[model samples]
Target chain A: MSHTLHREGRRRDLRGEFIVMSMAAKGINDAGAGPKLRRFLRIARKHGAVSVSDVKSVMHAVFTDIGAVESVLRDLRRARLGLSVTVTGLVAPIHRACCRSEVAEEPHTVAHSLGVWGNRRRLPSETVLSVMTMCGHSLVSVPLVEQAVASVRAGVCSPRAAAVKLAEPCVCGIFNVDRAARLIARLARSGKRR
Target chain B: MVQISKSKCVCCHRCALFCPVAAIRSGRDGASWIDEAICVECGVCVRNGCLSGAIRRRRSPWPRSVRALFSDPVTKHRSTGVPGRGTAESKTNDVTNRIQPGQVGLNVELGRPGVGTSFHQVQQVTRRMAKAGAGFEEQNPLTHLMSDRRRGVFPRELWPERVLSVVVEASLPLEELAGVLKELRAVERKIGTVFSVSVYCRWADRRRMLALVDRRRLLPQAKVNVGLGRARRQR
Candidate 1:
């Protein structure tokens, strides 16, 4: 009974799953991959596809994927979906990759990066720049981070609160609060001495 | 990277309230001003992110032009002339001829949805890859920031420049993946940013990649890109 109700609820929302995973079958002779394309589109439409991205030869959907829908896709056949299924590829969150290996090379220095800026601006201190650049949309600024830094040092706001406060402007929830707090703490300490 | 129509704006703070990064600040006149340094260009505040229809996209010039490409899904990259942020189909190693056999494509995507990374962070990874002699995807937008391709360094001038997110695509000998991973892990510790990675290799090397993922203690989650746009013809 709950499952049925849950599915009815699912129809409206993918159940808060924001991560969009898209699958594509690539390559074609001269006729076109239209049928397969339509099949993928049909499935995406059925699932309430959020954002459909067109890339010339590929159509990628940044839509929510979940369990009830997963089963349907699992049973999905190539012929039914429409395509010869020549090659398969994947796109995913870049963060999941964390592997350990020995490094024979040294890390790059900040000095070398400041290459010919004419009258252009130099990014703030590494710490400030790090915290400010967390949002992929470039919505965070150094002044705001600096203000947060000042507040944290003044006891006006805790580092956690400051980080949370800074993260408020971004709606994606991709802000790194833990890292922001650490940076805020560091920036606050630096501010205290200044 | 976001445009606000002053005339159309009702001074509604809904966009500000919903903005995850808090990049939107109101001026004394009640007009909302976006700090470019912090704005990652995500259209949340513009595309239905605002009920007032006051927010829109602001086209940037030259180096700053990259804002829309990486931030807006609809903006086409001026460099590659492609419609997406990362490299064309090449990022997938399909027909782009960018990545060849026995090679693994290591995409160090700097920045998440909320926590966008800067060219400064992207440079850290690119420089490391460049130092190791890894080939960057020529068509990738991030490569355009390389002040010196040889040194794997972004021009110092552009360092202060920030973006919501960027993908650093590089290809190296499959065997050298370990060293790159180690350097990346080290970077993870020093930099106060959050980023993820994507490793693309031949299907034959899937097991090896999974083993590396297991070794790193990471979850084996991946997004599949099924190219439905390519047209197929019968023989």
Candidate 2:
């Protein structure tokens, strides 16, 4: 199929999910999902970049039925599969997953990988904190920075493990563990690892 | 000069919602119309706010009927304000090009210069102008324009430009100062023009403001001017 056709199909699929998610979350009978998604997509494409915040805002407005898992899947599929999804929004889902995971080992690995792959583009504080809390850290701060050393020590998850888990679904690009580790260490010192 | 078609408007109200001046109004037909007199012509609504092509922009008034006039330097300069064909060179010449050390806080009067201004006022104005300059550099023109007048440069270039004398009023917060500097650096990359800031403050507080300027020609032309009556007393 032509790229345009492929994108239209994917948009239709996303529109469906957006409707389902909105209905589930808001308990509303409104059928404006398709229009809303189209609007969001149009704006995102026009801007050429979408932030995690953008996805979260739309998802929240849609009533959060688009859970972290589905969103992450969508983002990963978009990024790895070249699905023409919003770039920042695609990264947002994975970042959201990293925040919600309960396996003490996964969140840190994801954070490190994200830091390396995303480079200096900082992830939203909520996403970082969600990941930290998922790995068993306290939720004392809604969007505050947590001490990397304390969080890691509390969770007992190594950085290498975190990187590996994050790199798995990223089919398009390989994550460099060494680079991730170094970036993580630097971020930790600068109190920015989160 | 754009007309919004009511039939095509979705009544998303995005245009009215984001109008900086709140000039857009929703009509009975569900389309938004701009109050032409109050519309600042910022174009924010036309650019980012309008999702539907309902807004149609009309060109501004024309100056002439002849085609040859387009190449005339005087006509072009009069039309654009910035000199025709030599905008880059003219901008370079408009301000003193030298970046003098310890000049960051120099208090230089922009626009019509007059009295009743104290050192404290000058410092305040300079600080605000610097912050605004920084904000402009950061590509956060909205924030810069909306920032406290004491910490922002009154963009004389903006349409419907008002004539108001600017004076440095007071010292700004340190973090804000740093943010302003960072913004200036960022702007330098975009506009290719370095801003020369002027700082003014009480003689006793001079050192403090000077420390902030930090020997950079970013701030220069520091001076003290007596208020209207005080100027006569000194004379």
Candidate 3:
């Protein structure tokens, strides 16, 4: 009876954590929230299987959003529940639901955000995710771009500043210098350059 | 000969940083010196560093081969002109056959005779040989591996093993000499896995002796100095 009660308490804790994470993920996916949600979720999926500390480290690096952190915490809880359920030998019903709903929804949400971001930019959707994963913010965030450009103009930034501003981690990572230069030149030509 | 005054040496380490071959080394006195054998006489050190006016080229007589090429009758005739009013043919032949000391003039089969083999062709042949043997017979890898092994067996070889030598005047200050040496060593280290270096200051600066090696046999004959005319006079 004591064991049963302990298990029940753990389950409740996990459910609470999952609820918090799910709500945060949903909030990030909301229209106009930017790509922070998908970014966090992708990070969670990539690193969530590791220790909670590892997941948190990845989160701290990649996501500045509070909601994203909450989502990660919840995902951890859900992972614990999934592990616990699997251990308890209650396999059939849980397996069906896990395969149908949990597995499908997570990637779907990530794909949706990628599709949205792709519509506006020529960058590969995966590249956007990678940038968000490493930088902790959306690629199109104005503040980040401005800061990066400012650093470059001041001669303090490395050679990859403009690409980095566009969400590339480094200069080599964005092998699209011509395209970027063209964009900048076009902007400058049209009086729209920053 | 080039001279480095004692007061001008700063030890900022720029010369050491840019030497294409790591033939330079910093001495305990905080001055730089050149290892002659390792320095390629590239003049990169003299050009890049030496903010103190410490490094200068020495003067020496021109080599006979070079002088002979320039002193040919055809060259003298071209330069002297024909009895105040030279014929156009003589002028044209003089112009066509003229061989400047440093400039590599193109060979004209019908013009004046050519001298030593063209350096451009030599370099091209060397490049082709390098490329042809780059995959299997390249010496760099063997040299590197041997040097690594030798370091465990011999410690003294570390400083003198992998250098290109250059010549400087005997009057060059110890500090300037050290600077040049240090610069060359740094450059060598950057280019390859430099295992050892040794510098021989010849005639007090007229020339530098360098003993350098990677991992294989010791290369002890590299030398650097100011070219012929420059090595003879101390400047």
* Candidate number achieving the greatest TM-score relative to the actual structure: 1
Q: Candidate 1 at residue A75, lDDT?
A: 28
Ranking by lDDT: 1, 2, 3
Off by over 4 Å in 2: A1-194, B62-80, B83-97, B105-208, B211-235
Please state the error at residue B168 of candidate 1 in Å.
0.7
Candidate 2 local lDDT, B1-235, one digit each (tens): 4467777788887676444344688888776887764453434456546777777665444221111111111123233332221111101111211112222222222211111112222233345445555322221112233234436533433323211122122223433444454443444343211122333333233345446544633211111111100001111
Model 2 sits at an interface RMSD, in angstroms, of 30.1
Q: Taking the tens digit of each residue's C-alpha lDDT, what string does model 1 give over B1-235?
A: 5777778778866667555456788988998878777876666677545777788776666667766677655455675354456653222333233545566677665654235667777777777777677777676666665778776788776676665567677777777877877777667666655555656555445556555543343322333322212333456
Q: lDDT tens string, model 3, B152-235?
A: 121232333221211011112223333433443333323322112222222222112112212232221111111110011112
The best-first sequence of candidates by TM-score reads: 1, 2, 3
Best by DockQ: 1
Error (Å) of candidate 1 at residue B88 is 5.6
What's the CA error at residue A14 for candidate 3, in Å?
55
Candidate 1: segments with Cα more than 4 A from true spot: A1-31, A43-194, B1-8, B77-83, B88-101, B213-217, B224-235
TM-score of chain A of 3: 0.22
Of models 1 and 3, which has the larger TM-score?
A: 1
Better of 1 and 2 by lDDT: 1
What's the DockQ of model 2? 0.01
